[model samples]
Target: MRNTVLDMTRLATMDAEHANRLLHQVRAAILAGRRPPVAPRPVIDASWQRMLRLGFDPDGRTSSELLQPDELEHRRRATVIGEVMRTLSGGLTEIADASLQIMVVTDPQGRVLWREGNAGVMRRANGICLEEGAAWTEDTTGTNAIGTALAARRPVQVHSAEHFVHTLHNWTCAAAPVHDPRDGRLLGIVDVSGPASSFHPATLALVNSVARLAEAELRERHRRTVERLRSVAAPILCRLTGRALAVDPHGWTAAVTGMAPVDRLPLPKTFGAGRVWLPSLGMCTVEPLPGGWLVSPEESGPPEAANRVVLDLSRPRRWTVAVSGAAGSWTQELSPRHAELLYVLAKYPQGRSAAELAADVFGDPTRTVTVRAEMSRVRRYLAGVLAHRPYRFSEEVRVEVLRPSHPSDLLPHSSAPAVVGERQMPGQDVSAERRRS
Candidate 1:
């Protein structure tokens, strides 16, 4: 619950003889196709089960394949994670070197993008194929820190013999997932790894702290970018009136006139000059602006509540929610972010505040601004049904969610904290319903 790798730390502190005996018992149980011994923590037992399902052979050798230099360089250039790497590396370098450990950064898919520190350990790492460009996913490498942390969406430490592969039994690793501050998408992982003897309980805390710092840096960078956009929008908004606003590409409002400020609007991926239907504003004139979009509201009647809302998340890439009322039935395809927000809202019909929704979607309670902007868009479509002041669907309307036969397929592209947590819940046919008042 602390989100640190306290389990492995506890293992590290055990007397050598007791630790070895426990390890032996776990290994024997796993080899015999039995549940892990009680000595192994629940997280470790879960990892072992996942590895077994993935067809990993505990006795087999781990792969040492590295990506070609050109491919590695290309991936590094394309990732946003590179922007915060300098900050992460600076904080980790001294500690990594002092402990004879190596600091590794991996993309969400568990491909190692960078490695640094502990020259002697670096060379030794190569023998196990723990180098830049090598894939260390749980499916590929079996129960290592980097992959398991990504799988668990939290910090974890995997110590010697806890590793599924025999070849990695001599190593230890602590890793925490890093996320994009703007949307809670997993960007990569920051890991500290070395010979098992060099394992330290404090490393999990250190890694988690640095990962948080990296996310904060990303948030600051995004804020600065939005501020620059606001400067561009300022002069433009002065000439506009009558409930008009200027919004950046991601829908963050840069400026508003003759209207209360809204966090953001839902603009299509390829928005251009046109008349578009906006949720709260009805049909609106959309025009391209220097840094974003300028939208002016058009007249429309209040939304009718003789409606049923159906959330369809069964398809692969396409997610949609349909609204049916006396006016007619209409369905809107959702982007990954929108899909995640709606899913969380539907799950808790009791309603959620901006901060609560922020914590659910972004894993940070202070991101209410972001949550408010997104919810503004959601309200546009479900105007009469969605009520604010602690957002919730109107009790008079029935809500239903259609999910995939396999829960894992729900919102396949989302890595938002709440989405990840839902995917892991045990169920096949998942659905949530709220009845009319």
Candidate 2:
């Protein structure tokens, strides 16, 4: 018989009791370091692996101090998510209440910013401290929808026994992350949670739909804001005779004069009005617009040199690259894949071809197409330091990599073939590991 993936949703819909029992068995077996009768979903399995690696106790109590009243109020007013709360609540509140669940909205850090729904459910939630200001990130609450979705940077559903912590096994949650449509940064999470007995596979789909709707609302609002800014910018750019452009706070182009209209420009880390240097635009003068900035580049020599590169992967959750030289300095956060690729490059200064990189990352040299596409994206920002022929950092630039304290903890979110192999390596550094790879 061909082995196929298990369908937890269908099973739970038909017979929740049987499904719960089976999941308990599977969770117990997996936690005890044994093969389960059936495996959990890939997302859940990955979360469990991370928890295990960190020695998370499945039976331990889970809770954290609530945010102070003043800080909680400030967060509520500070996040962009607050702008879409009404839309999210309108789309999800009724459904959650009808299902005897609660609608929850959390900031990217997984702190509850707002929650509402069934009256009885609200009281029960208080028992678990699932109210405003509670931190629900995986580090504090284990593998559940709000925390796991935040960790994975995507939507997730955690049913009975799928949770790494025993306390959460009695609850079911479906959460989808809301990201800023302008730049793709995580804004927050929208979740529906209730007692395990109330589990409905369809709740996941509902939450995801509402999250997408919230993004649409944000996108439409931004369009109108930019249009208004354009009115203010068009006159300003035409008045002065120079390479001047107006951009939204996020660096989205609104109006331009004397240059090609670029959709967006990457702004420097420390951007402000007055004389400042941008790597792309060179020396520029900036002035505050109502919702954006007006940038005028002084007709000068050239953009600054970016010779030194520092890839910092020392933290478990965050990774960034800082570049600096004769001109100025700036930093950009690297995605998980980018971090892995950069780590590999930093190990072997000799560089790796597309095929070799595919083999190093996927353990399959045939996946060169994917490797090349990713390198193209990396090159977009690092064109100065990256070279193409064989896909390597330029020799003229110095590349420094900051590694995690424990080699095994490197790229905690990465399970690429090369990353996993390196994490399991016995040695201290990658010199001997390079030969093994």
Candidate 3:
């Protein structure tokens, strides 16, 4: 739902009378040589154009007017922000001498939602006014962390020269955009800032990881609410169904009008990994079982089903084959970088050292870290391959091992070559519960 109450309250607070007076004072200060309109002149950029297209409508609303104290109080924005601040602090504190000092969150519309950081960094960022309720659209604030992120919907790193604000030229920031799971909607942004000289490549990853963590929490909040509602409504449907459960998509459930004992209930999969949805009565998942489908409420259930059967075999013409590389050669199915990395790992039983692997592969010492990071990513890719098992690699002796899990061990005798599609990527097909970030 839209934040109607907060929006209405903000509009009332930023009334014309107050705005006119504030503008007059600003003009007077400029005339008296007490302040300048801004430190440097602003210029248009691609980020600005994007924000405008995204409905980041800017008017003359001040901080107080844009965010009402009452709404802030009711929503406990401070408390939530405080928790986010703590999470960020924990995420950054472990890095050795990490210069990251500030972090902030902003709504999808480019309004500052929350901010927290060290005193020194806050003082430095004050000129940009990154406090709660301030606008952070690229056009208004220039190419800063919050603005550029919302504009691009991707993680970005902006150094001193990239900052549009002249006074903010000494700082660098990295930010990532978070999305809502239900429809993959852009929700907010999370950003980290530090001195411009702190340009470690990992800085971007740190910011993205923080944003991902925050986005996870938000998704969990929504999932819990939906789960609770599902819990309450499930049993009621079970009692009425006479059949005890029903499973379908979200739209199917919405079409049913009056309550019936055997009403067709739609069960949109709660967690996307395993293909199943449970609707009504017991909250059990209506999953494909040995012969047909069965509903089970327990988290742990009988295994050996297919990966979501979207096709109905009774209707033969709907048969589809998801193609990748040819059989017995899964390595060939991956991208060039992924294919080479996996091939090397497959041959080395004891794995390899970072230096040894880099020399053999990329032939550059500086590329060692880069290769190691990609190996870390290969582990994530292996998750879908082995029922989400962790892939291990030693940095000291860089050998990738899958530890011979059940799924991985069983893969040798599997019917045919498995084609895990792009959906296997994190956040691609998981249901709302697992869609955190």
lDDT for each candidate structure: 0.79, 0.82, 0.44
Q: Model 3: per-residue lDDT, tens digit, 39-106?
A: 22111233433334444433222122356757544433533433455555467544423464666666
| TM-score per model over all chains | 0.75, 0.86, 0.41
For model 2, name the residue pairs that clash.
Answer: none
lDDT of candidate 2 over 186-208, digit per residue (tens)? 88899999999988778889899
TM match of model 1 to true structure:
0.75
**How much is the lDDT of residue 284 in candidate 1?**
79
The candidate 2 region of ten consecutive residues with least summed lDDT is 428-437
lDDT comparing candidate 2 with the true structure: 0.82
Listing every candidate in turn, what is its Cα RMSD in Å to the true structure after a full C-alpha superposition? 6.0, 4.0, 19.6
Worst 10 residues of 3 by lDDT: 309-318
Pairs with backbone N, CA or C atoms under 3 Å apart (clashes), candidate 1? 279-380, 280-380
Best-to-worst order by TM-score is: 2, 1, 3
